[model samples]
Target: MNLPNQLTEREPIDPKLAVGSSLPNPKGLLAIVLALYLVNEEKDHLDYSDKSGNTIILKPSLITSLKAFFNGITGYNATEIDSLASANPLVEMQIEPLQVPLQLFWKIAKINILGTDSSSGERTGGVRFPKELFFTTNMDILKNVISNENGDITNTGKELIYSWLTNNNTPTSSVNIEQKLTKTLSVFSEETLFKTWNNSTEIIFQQEGIYNAFDTTNATVDIGGTKEIKGTLRNLKSSISKDIHPYLKISSSNVELKNPSLATQFDNYQKRVSNYLDLNPKSIEIKIVETEEEINVDDVTILNKIYYGAPGTGKSHKVNELLKGKEERTERVTFHPEYDYASFIGGFKPITEVDAESGKEEIKYKFVPQTFTNIYVDAWNNKDNEYYLVIEEINRGNCAEIFGDIFQLLDRNSDYSITPSNELKQYLVKELTSVDGIKGIENGKMKLPSNLNILATMNTSDQSLFPMDSAFKRRWDWEYIPINYEKSEENPSSHYQVVVSDSISFSWLEFIEKVNTIIKENPNLGMDKCIGNYFIKAKDNSITLEEFINKAIFYLWNDVFKDEDDHIFEENTFYEDFFPIATKGKEKVLKILEKIGLNTPEKED
Candidate 1:
């Protein structure tokens, strides 16, 4: 057999003649049986490395057949070969008994199946079979069989073995080999064969003859002969009982079962101890630790939420603050008046590409994913982590038109799904088929993963631009962001001062409080048109004369008090009067501040 380049070779085995009744390890016996079948068929070699780095050479065809056999028993379609092979930790534990059987095959059966080196010691390892030992139907039967954790053959193993032996065409010469295998299979039984084999091993025989004492009726089995140990059985039973029933009382010397029906289970536990002693034959310690629960994404009651407030009230800032450290897990999009479903979700976009074979520039239209699709796929692929899809200025665009049929997914009470278009379905199927928990993506329907959260911001002032209907509005949990007027660290804008000149300045928060009171009193201009504390940001804690007139004065004149008869501005005063170039621009702004009950300080000398 020629091993693959990734495998490492081990030292040559020292060939020894057959001694007493040393049975082959169950997993190793299964490997050799499969190897014999493949050798008869002249298949190419397959190589695998044990945990100790020793290379085990077999046939590549074994992977496909073994995968099918395992899938039949497990009832799951295992796509990767490694999932069924020893590379998986669980599978490795199941088939680890191959170690002792390899040595036994060489010693007892005179098989040189273990790899060897060339004359120059180049380590060219391969499998060599004797001419007399050819493959048979019995070999195929043993290849597909499975064994229990105790190394005993299962019912499936027994059925396969019986079918192999009952065949009429079985050669008479093969009966001798099959009989030897039957004897080897008996060695896995804990009751009769193990006790007989235990007598030959010196170390196991001396352990108070405990193997013989293990019966269903026995209340106590001695571990230490003539030695009084403190809490020995209590500690031993405590560790093993975690796997067994808890209906047992632990004394200093013995573990007494509360019920008589548990005797068989206790007897099996004793057999496991005997098996461990037979393998170890030396002093060993065992310790058990409790494993911690796995971490998962935090649950939220509101899956879809929208923060609504006036402009410059930190609605977007609140969303960003909640997702402060998790920038990588979040996808952000800003909605506009022209925003459509294709732009928010996904659509086919034209791409200019150069053909590799023809060497010509070609234009192709491909389905391209936008913010929604990008975050949706990411959330499904990584279900253990939380993902965010943040939409800024959500009310600026038509909600019903932009969300389209995807609005059905907002109700996460159940696994709400929507059938995507043909283009999106094909793209999603290609990306999501390999992932485990994600379903319906391969079929045309799609749902948001539980870990995905959609958060949006809406300005109450712009809510009338593309008014959302009651159906769409009720789907989202609405939160209102109120303006803070108190001067504090969080409300930095409260300390800002609007400067009309060197001496003529007033507190920005005080000005907002007075103007907001008037705006609230008016029926047309309510809280929606009220000036926000942070409507205009200040430079170095001071709102310059130019900044104040450009932002605050502009908004109030045009938006808030544009058509109101009871306005703050002087009679017939145009918006251009707030400009510096105007003759009475500065004087007009001062009179309006005083009228709004804001203090206008005298100019400095």
Candidate 2:
């Protein structure tokens, strides 16, 4: 066969070839091993039935030894011939075709001494053994060596079997032979021997006939193809062993051993099988190709945006929705009054460490990275994936002091860069050196990658706490989340009702509309002082009398209408009078609602 130059050209063979009726029954490592042994013993001329119409029979002694062998390996007794025969072929046609791949594995492991070529016009012929065979003559010794008292092969027995199989031509340890055979057999069972196809019998026979052709000199000419095959087989074995390890019925009674060499072999073999059983190679490869395609697509637009609104207007919720599935790519930090450059960027912080020479615990100042530096390095390292840095309550912190020299990075379009301190320069060199598309770090200057997005949320009510200057404010695109009064599924607060009493309740949105109108009409308090739709979320869609007075009524009396000559509350009514303990406190709130045209005796539906 003239193989293609690229390994990708050799698409995986039809999956049916690995699972169809042509393959052996009870497919497993044990079944394949036993089948190979039987094929070798029978010299490819084994009969499945006698003239009396009974199946091929075994001697009682041989049957008992086989049962012991099966029990030793699987911890399960063979109560009938069918259990043993399931692994063995039942017809001459089935028996003859298995030798091609079986002998190929043996040949790969340099143990092809028991069989001779039997060419019957097939691409790969069946094995025909010599009249007297060393393996057949010493069958009892082999069985005893494999199934000793401890149900494990001793080193001495392994050496004996190795020497017998290879005739000392390969100068290697017995462990090497064990690994070679185990790996080759695993690949044979998963990749070649068990494959099936829904083709004509002639086509299936032709495909099976060529199993050994890959071992020929012509196939070896495409060295790249050979290496690719070997790599895929290794990955296949690893994937299968991992999938099957959890379900393997390993026990002290079975042939699986605790010895390091055998245990390692078993551990390696245990990692594969489950995925191979249900594998659709084409679909799996397509997913991988799709991932690569996604990486090459256009990068997401970089954002330096701020979401600002009155308290409880879902400013934070807006940012969360935009970053729903990109959690791994996002980092969030809430800015407070105490936040500064050291906390926002990288700095030398005291960390506990063990002294290498003294073997004692001590404190050391290391360049510890905060959210900004951490996400900055990650964004440059993984340029294909979008990264985010979210700052909550941005106006709560003094941005000028918190950003320091790094504030220049907010102007992403500029080619400007910042020179780090000596400690930070060394850290940046270690992290950003040799990273593609990142420049000037080695020269002690650094700039942000285009894939990094900086998002912040601000409460308009707190704008006076630490007002951001014009330079800092101009760099970010600002968005305002207005109060949503529409009583729809999207507006959770629209369904809320302030429970004034058992017989009197009013829509929370209606109360806000009335109170906001009064606040807007007052010259001292306008839109900024208007109550937000979500100023207080209701529990079970009901805001209790206590919560309503403590939160809503208190804020309106103290903050919004405290200095206004015209207000919504009754004359001489103070904030304390709205408390539950005040005389007729609930009645006073009901009267205020009636004054605002919201005291209709109706409950939420």
Candidate 3:
């Protein structure tokens, strides 16, 4: 069977909680996040309206603003970001404060803005933070909200935070942020402090933001080692003042403990707290490692996701790593209604055997191993590892009939089921001649061994076939394979160097785009035949190129039209209002064929 080339093949992946694939597009992200929330809330309709009556659908403006905010704080603490909402909350959630590492997100936003030049007053490196974050300004109102009726900017900076949110909807420009200030600056009106003020660093209220709430206690600190062995960490409230407390860090190796100058106090406090609490050390690797037997279904290469897709795709190349030229150990079977249990499972056969009474060879019943029985029984007796059964053109036969009772055995999820009652029981009990080259088991049923995998190839292009049954379809994971054509190394500018190659190179995306435009301009064409599967059987480079040319000619003629011997290579028969039929009329077909610049030269191969 000819298999088309596939464009992408993901490396073997472990099926743990790998970060989910990125949403297809930005809009898809919004939809998925919304869908998750709505599902969680059990709401029949989504609540698009904000606390205010205004709807807040994902908009280009909002997305742009968000991107800016993320880029602004490129280097910040990760633990500081624990409050952000996520698609899966429980997985990323951390109950303890020390477990929060603040450095993770700092790098993300930093990367976004690195080397980027900004047009607006935003993107300034200083803490003033990309100005896009402060797009909305009702600062005074917010101050007033947290402080009941207190309009004084100097006295009410902290108190007015609560009232601002209650009075209006969630402020659009980076409104939701909550963190106890490690260091605060005083706020003052010109009239209040010095009475006459040009801007000065002098403060009206010296106590503002000057408080540290959590203090340090005891620690288990090391003198010098990269790996932190043991440590004590604590979040203590200062007896003198709540804001003056420190966070302690502890470790067996003090080398890793070295950091920014201000880290000394927090580090010492963390060391004390960890030992006092008998806590685990810092820096835990987060990769989820799974045991072999408990391996996730994704991680296990069942080899079932056969690369079947749009034409020109590379399905065979994907298996090149395993099947380049090596002899195959897999059992390949073609299913047809004519296939019987005798060919699938072991069957009782009458053969000549020596009988002592007759002193001559006599017919006796013996079991003959079938394809399914061979591989399965081999693994049962000898654990020589993996066994495979690849069925090509899987749907060509009545699968349910040909497969009979074995479909359930091959199912991905079915581990154990009662022995199928019918002509299969005795055959299922039959043993194979070779068990991975070892002797076989006499009474074992034909069980699908743990390491056995099944690969079935199907072509959706086939018009005649029963729709794949639900029981059969539900178990297989589907992967859409795309085309990846082999490009030639010839140069066209110099005819001498331009060695003509078969199947001219074309970008799938570009081709699809062109087709879309043609469909829009001329509605009469049916997409089904518009070169849906454009593959050429290349006997050699020359023959291959000819086959490609013929395919193009047929596609141009038959796809956008019907039979048209009279069609010119440059005529226009398409009408503005006429929708294209599956097969175009002779005249229109000829016109389109000519329009598309197609021709087929007779070739002797």
Candidate 4:
């Protein structure tokens, strides 16, 4: 703190002074020279130093803890230097084109593409393929193709592409994804990969030399001895997905206007047209039925490729049955009001990271395969099987938002290729995708099992309603399944079935007829809301006869007489369905029934 008047300063190493070096004289001058020397020290010396030996005089501002960085005690923001590094996008993968021996080979192994030996296996039809074709014993060569008589492997690529087929997540990412053989035995890799067969057995990719096979360009490149390539047209799974987009599904609309007297008086032409639904004034088809005269369903997968309808009517249940063991796959997803894209795809979720000390807030990336996503993935590369995705209550939420980039994927009629959603692109490179090089979904086509059929179910009665856009409307086959009232030898008794506590109960066919009459007389009341589920809850939970009436009355209060009731009759009338408890659990329903009245009959003896 002393001024130039009288003060002493210590110098760590005194530099040789010029004959007239006046800085060596006064203490203030000595401080100046020492400060300059310390500040100009080499960078390595700055890393560690003995500051206690000498005080390097610096500006008082530099001594302030926050500003000490300027003094170089803590190194300068040297990390900024990284900004000068060069960025090169070209990626390279190295393959040492080695010639390996045909150490092992097999023939005509009877196998099924479905990967099963069960009764279902018989359905795919047994195909003979080369089997146990191993590069070595530990390495099991996956048999995926057949060989023809003319010294050529079938397009199936079964002769050579060993573990890569059956073992997924291999060739992990596309980058320079080349395989190397450390212990090159009889040239098992090189011979099949480079020579002998020429283009006859393996596809000679146009890509010359080593390059990132994961790149979009190489996605179509067929590898040596591999029966299948990612992007090629011959790929069955991708093709099937391309074909089924435009099929219309119609099963849930009642075209009849229910005017019996008017029907009786109408001309034959009028009755025929009304039955066709196009002539019905209030008819709305949930799934399109290919009537005698109407637009055929679009044949594109991205065209309204999905259809969701009522529960017990067996919308999903029916679609699954249609495909049943007939198709290769049947995938299902239940869409609630809360279903989200994150649950469908991949996302960052909260997690705990523990170390030697304790846990800390961390993010764990989770790849959540949505019901549709998994189906699409499994179906994408396989050509031999049909895949189905059943979205229960497909429209309960905003499909446009929830589907993100894949909304286009559901377009059954649009062009199938497209850019992936922004979210999927942000987290990964194209190498991560299952199909060829599908960086995104575009043109309404999901890069999936070309055979994928989407069947979505939307209970027309759900409260979380949405008005489907006109464009989306035309893309589907909206079928309405109205109740079949007459039950005889041909129509046979259509009983009302219910599931209660694991046990099932059925009422007479007449019960459905009575309810059908009520719904017919009152168009505002939907059969899905008033009939099926009503009986389900009643018969399943064992509600008494009075309890059934009380529950049915509450059900009517929902949309049946929702807005019509007055406030004075609110408690007793049970309109608006209580707003909250229309979709309540058993507990809330018990409470509502207790307060108002009972569905149970009086127990007077």
Note the Cα lDDT for every prediction shown. 0.55, 0.54, 0.33, 0.33
Off by over 4 Å in 3: 1-300, 320-328, 336-342, 346-366, 421-447, 485-534, 539-594, 597-605
Error of 1 at 56 (Å): 28
Better of 1 and 4 by TM-score: 1
- Candidate 4 per-residue lDDT, tens place, 1-605, comes to 87576566642111111000111111121112212222333111111111212111222331232122222422233232121111000000000000001111111011121233211221111222111111222222211112245633333222112112112222333111112211111112211111111232423221111112323333232232322222211111221222211111111210121233443333342334334433323222312332212212111122124433333343454444444343435556676667777776546565555544555555565444456555555554433344466666777776665666665555554456555545454433432354432422433233533456666666666735755676565656665644344554333324333211133232324444444455545555545554442233434334443344355545555545565433112355433443433233333334433333333222223
**Candidate 1 residue 546 C-alpha distance from true site, Å:** 1.0
lDDT of 3 by residue, 1-605 (tens): 99988888653322111111111121122122222222223222222211112111222333333333233332322332222222121112111111111111000011111122221111111111111011012222223332334443222222122112112222232232211112110011100100011132111110111112233441232222221111011111111122211222323221122234656664554455445434422221222123222233322344355545533333333333233221234577876646666777667788888888979998887776778776666455433234467666566677676667777765654444445443445544443434432222233333465556676665543314645788876666665444322333321111111012232222322333334345435544333223222243333222222333345434544544444443323445333212222223323333433343433222223
Residue 273, candidate 3: how far off, in angstroms? 28
Regions of candidate 1 where Cα sits further than 4 Å from its true position:
1-302, 433-437, 440-442, 581-584
What pairs collide in candidate 1? 1-127
**Which residues of candidate 4, in runs, are more than 4 Å off?**
1-312, 326-328, 350-369, 426-449, 488-508, 523-530, 533-553, 562-605
TM per candidate: 0.52, 0.50, 0.37, 0.40
Error of 2 at 308 (Å): 1.0
> Candidate 3, TM-score vs. the true structure?
0.37
